[model samples]
Target: MASDSLLLTADFPRTVRGYAPSAVDEFLRSLGSRLDALQNQLDQQAARCEKLTADLSAQAKELAGYRLKEAALAGALVATEQRRAEVEQEAAGLVERAREEAEGLLAHARAEAEQIVGEARVRADQLVAEARQARQAEEARILDLCAEFDAAVETMRRTLEAHLALLPEPGSTLAELSLGGLAVADAPDSLAQAA
Candidate 1:
């Protein structure tokens, strides 16, 4: 049906001589072979176009999948950035607190050290005062003992002089008799000088 227009039609007149039969038959056969080659070329071109269309559709689908993956990765990157920011903020807060605590500890240590030094100074002063008092008291006791010794020596000298006045004169027998070389002549003078 599609090749109807290309077909050769015979219109021989009833009174005129018709075309040569062998030549017409040869021309028809050559035309039919050319038509057949043209139809084969058209069918090949259609098959190639269909394969190209199918390849284009597959490429479009692959492009859509890549776009979806890119969008998902973008969202994940944004979330990671947000998390990093939060962690940094928290670390900063902790560092600030640690610094404040360290400062407080340093201040407390300084105060304690000062207090200890003050107490040591007070104790040292008290010890020096006590030693000075003890030294003064000992010196006073020594002076009192020296005074008592002098008083006892003075009383003994007076008693010896009074007892010598009660003895006999030097020309008497008692003065001639030696009693372990005890001469009473210079007794008062020696006792006064020794006292």
Candidate 2:
């Protein structure tokens, strides 16, 4: 692991066992060149490693952001589901209340209809009773008129019979003069029947 500066500047002692200075200098120069090439290769590798580390860090940050977005979307989905359930419950309650109200209204209407029918029936009965009373009164009045008519006819027949008794016998001149076209026997009976 000799440095390039030390290799270039190293000196050998002059002795019987020492190597030639020219040959040693040549070998040291070759070793220094090879070391410099290896160092350059190592520096290039280090630069590539640093760039790859930065790229990895950026990708990790992007992955973390995507995970956060996914979590937020899941939370939103859960909240939406809860809200939809609440709305469905509210709609069901509203429908139930409407049905109850409609049933109540129907019951009320039925009661009113029954009451009205009952009143109508009572009024009809009253009207029928009044009609029957009026018919009975008219019948009684007609019967009284018939009785008065029969009594007047009986009084007129008696008056005619008394007048016929005052008349002469059938063949008399006075009877013939008084009853112009009737026979005496038929006169009283015919006049009474006509009356």
Cα RMSD of all models vs. native, in order, equals: 27.2, 27.0
Distance from true location, Cα of 165 in model 1, Å: 99
Which residue pairs collide, candidate 2? none
Q: Relative to the unseen true structure, what is the C-alpha lDDT of residue 191 in candidate 1, on a scale of 0 to 100?
A: 46
Over 1-195, each residue of candidate 2 has an lDDT whose tens digit, in order, gives: 458778778877788878887888999998888888888898989998899899899989999999999999999999999999999999999999999999999999999999999999999999999999999999999999999999999999999999888767777663354454565545787663553
lDDT of 1 by residue, 87-122 (tens): 999999999999999999999999999999999999
Candidate 1 wrong stretches, greater than 4 Å: 1-16, 77-195
Best lDDT goes to which candidate?
Answer: 2
TM-score of 1: 0.32
Residue pairs with colliding backbones in model 1 are none
Cα-based RMSD of candidate 2: 27.0
TM-score of each: 0.32, 0.35
Per-residue lDDT, model 1, residue 119, is: 100
Local distance difference test values of all predictions, in order: 0.79, 0.86
